[model samples]
Target: MDSQHPPSPDSEQQTTSRKRRGIGRIGWAVLGTVFFGSLLLIGILPRLSQRSELQAAVKEASTIPSVDVITPRRAAATTNLELPGSVVPLNQTTIYARSTGYLRRWYADIGDRVRAGQLLAEIDSPDTDQQVLQAKAELAQAQANILQSRASLAKSVSDLKQARANLLIARQSWERWQVLVKQGAVPQQDADTKYATYQANLASVEAAQNTVNSDSANVKAAQASAYASQANFQRNTVLQSYKKVTAPFSGIITARNVNTGVLITAGSGNSNTSSSTSNTSLYTIAAYDTLDVNVNVPQSSSGILETGQTAQITVRELPQRVFRGKVVRTSNAIDPNTRTLLTQLEIQNSDGVLRPGMYASVKFAINRTNAPFVIPDSALVVNAGGTQVATITKDQTVHYQKVAVGRDYGTEVEITSGLTGNESLIATPTVDETEGLRVQPIAQTK
Candidate 1:
């Protein structure tokens, strides 16, 4: 606001020095601001670039899916096969009477153990006894007739010898008479009478020879009759032995159809008897020293079953017991309708714990030469292309491989034709995990 005055020299110098110092301070301040701004820009540019790179890496990692992988496991060599079977006695039979008679007494009853040739019952048949006696008498009479005929034959032979002697004498006399007639030493009538006597002697000799032949034929006929009578007697004696009922084999009697004084018919005729109408047989016997189990093996497993193969048998009634047996025989032919093989297994039942007609379950251990691989059901992928399994390649890429299934367990499946049991399989594959897609594999814990 005041008017300016002309400056002296010293004062002018002082004002000039002060203006220079203000200019220097402004220049230093501008330089310091520029240096600090450059430093800040340099630090911010590198950080921004690093942040961009980190974001890019995170985005790339998010694009690839992570998956849990498992290796396929191999199946076991032996498989257990279970089947139903029927238990039966080794030998069973229904005994019947061979002769018709009333049961007098029974030595064996139901549930009785008997040995071979043991008497079970006896029948008192008066008719059969009388028939046996009559046959014996007829045989004796026939033998007597044979003896008488033999004596008559001897007498006839002696008569034949006498006849022969007389024939020789008559022939000699006839020749002598003819010679005398020719020589005219005797009368013609006497010579003719001697010739007639010789002819009569010849006729008598022929009759005697015929009588001897007839008597010899009679002896032969009597002998033949005696032989027939003897055969009849022997047959009757055998029939009489049938009155005693005996066991043909050692066994246990399971049934008793006849008691004392019960009328029994011969053979296995009609089952309707006056005593009991329940069964046709006199007794049912079974030899249960051993037991037989019969099972029908399916065609799929028939080839693996063989004779001498071991088996385990179990019954529902005997839940705690397991019986061991072996394959004894087979039908050797397949059933057309059932498509099964009839197999028989034998088991020793010396303890008598098993009975006939019992239901049993038979288990067989079958070994497989070509065992397949087993994989979890979750690893399987079924698509329009067919059955497949998702696997991870070495390069961490998704791969879908075709697999053929064999046996299906509930939670696992058998790979029969596809897998080599060395591939890393995905535990579960999603739709996004297509073939050839890159994925990050994580090992799955069992």
Candidate 2:
């Protein structure tokens, strides 16, 4: 119908209107395409930039292993260390007879509590008593002999005086005979006889003097013999006193192997003769007023303990008890075979609750003069060489440090000789970690 109407003026005007409408439609299509294209570009440009950056970062990260790191915590001034231990009596001894004889009577038996001087048993030491009596009699006899020798000395002195008097009288008689012979009033024979009598009296005086000297020496010998006899008597008396067996210290008797009428030998070279546990002892006494908790502490932790440091003891038998103890002794040396120290803790046991050879746990609160850094237990690397840890420096270089470890608490460990607490430590070092490997350390948040 439009093609037939083209001869009219409306038809020309409609054709021109159609051309304008088509041009308007073409212009709107071009504007819509330009706007949509600009929106698409605006949305995709940032995404593309971000994807490029992400890919670049992945490539960089793949060259280095990412690791979580932790800063070591400063160790406390005092650290608690627990070690397995055994409880023992403070003083233990095996009793043996001091005198050789049969056991006469036992005043204290096994499980008996006795004082230091309490009688434990009696020995029928008849020979010791007989020896004491004999010594005493010999001493008395020696004293009597000394007295007799003194009397003989006195008699010899009297004889010497009598002989001296007789010599003086004979001298005077001889002098008178000589005068008579010179005066021709006496015979020569009488003068000669008086001279001979004087000479004989002089010889008797010399004999009496020698007898006095001999008697004096005899008295001295008797006195010395008496003194020796007295010493023997005293020594035998001391030996006799040993017949009464007594306790050497205050304690409870743990064992008694001898009874009345048992033949107990004295000073027999057996286990009882020494300080060790005696299998052939008459009795065994253990002092339980204090107990010793012996623990083998690691050499690293041993140096921190001292003699007066207080410790805690937990007994397995008494699970609820926490016994207060003091560090009494230590070997002060590291055992080469075990690499440990023998430490002993002393605990008061006045209540008699603790016994010897009981299982125990000893806790020593040792104060370190130089406290070590504490790190997570997972950071340690143990190998055939020794224990080590991985640390990262400020330059992001991995450093494998040889560390001395102490007091492992499962979650944490003490670095006794390595890091300065400020080092960034790797949680777990890999086998490929070296001293100068560059690493990407990620700080552990927790």
Candidate 3:
């Protein structure tokens, strides 16, 4: 019975007391509410203040000034126009073989100076030699025939004289017989016999005359044949002389195509001969002391060019030197396809410095006093209105000006109809700026 009432030991009595305690719970809830409310108020108030300051700063940045730029104008010296061309020999000749023969020996070669009629090479013409021998033999035979005909003609003439004497004697005998027949001292038969003898002698004289005529005709034929053979012999001799190739003019041999033992053919469409060595020319001579430069100038530049005008030439091989020359000739007509004028300049190359086939640059100093105002090409601005430039006014304002331009010199341009040359020009203008724009300029540094 004592334990069933409630065994309230010391630990059990303390637990019951704690379960009955609830007063501090309301105080803790009130403290948490006050802490959270203070945090909300502190965070929101500073953000609202910062937002207004940021707006004020943005407004201030909007009033900042723009950057300024400046440039200067300069006067440039007049320049000449430079063009490109090639060098060529003023007088060039190609040497060709006139007769074909085996090359025996070459006396001249490339770079060898030769005089007119100088021996260039020698040809072994065995065929031509044989022709000469044959012609000589024919001529001798013809002369022998002529001698035989003359002998025959002399014999015929002697026979004709004997026949004439016999005819005269027979005629005298016939007349004596006729007188004797009239005087009865001769028989008729005798007279008839004498008359027959005279007739026979006359016939013999006619036969001798015909023989002489035949001999004379034969002599004439032999003489003609001899003349023909002589002509052939002379032609062969002349052709044999051609075997030694001679220089046509005084010049330097620029080429040689023949060597020893090479076969050369006659020039009349016969290819039976072959050269002993490949790439051998008979001779090629040229006078390199004088040279010509051919230049193709644009049609627009053709009008100002004239014969006898001085030209300055620069060869690529001789870079450090310039050659002085004069215009020798011009085509006088423009080429339709290239739209250019073909001009030639003659240069004296006596020092052998300027060679043919060298590339060259020619400078033409054209007087362009009639040309318009010129400016730096950098000042031009290309847009929808053709070409324009930015000009600075006296009041420090910029103007976008339209201009008509001409020949361009890479870094400069010619103003054909647009500028007065007195105004200041800007080399480059900003895209955001336009006509009548106000600016504060700072001088440009070089």
Top candidate on lDDT is 1
Q: Rank the candidates by lDDT, best first.
A: 1, 2, 3
RMSD of each: 7.8, 6.7, 23.7
TM-score, per-candidate, Cα-based:
0.68, 0.75, 0.55
Model 2 C-alpha lDDT per residue in residues 111-182, reported as the tens digit of each score: 888889888888898888899999999999999999999999999999999999999999999999999999
What lDDT is reached at residue 228 by model 2? 100
Whole-model lDDT per candidate: 0.88, 0.86, 0.78
Ranking by TM-score: 2, 1, 3
Q: Clash totals for all models, in order?
A: 0, 0, 11
Q: Write the per-residue lDDT of candidate 1 for residues 289-371, one digit (tens) a residue.
A: 89999999987679889899999999999999999999999999999999999999999988888999999999999898988
Q: Where is model 3 poorest over a 10-residue stretch in terms of lDDT?
A: 268-277
- Which segments of candidate 1 are over 4 A away from where they belong? 1-75, 172-217, 268-279, 314-324, 372-445
The top-ranked prediction according to TM-score is 2
Model 2 misplaced stretches (Cα beyond 4 Å): 1-51, 62-64, 161-202, 268-280, 395-397, 432-438
Collision count of model 2: 0
Candidate 3: where is the Cα deviation over 4 Å?
1-79, 132-238, 266-281, 316-321, 333-339, 383-407, 416-426, 429-446
lDDT of 1: 0.88
Better of 1 and 3 by lDDT: 1
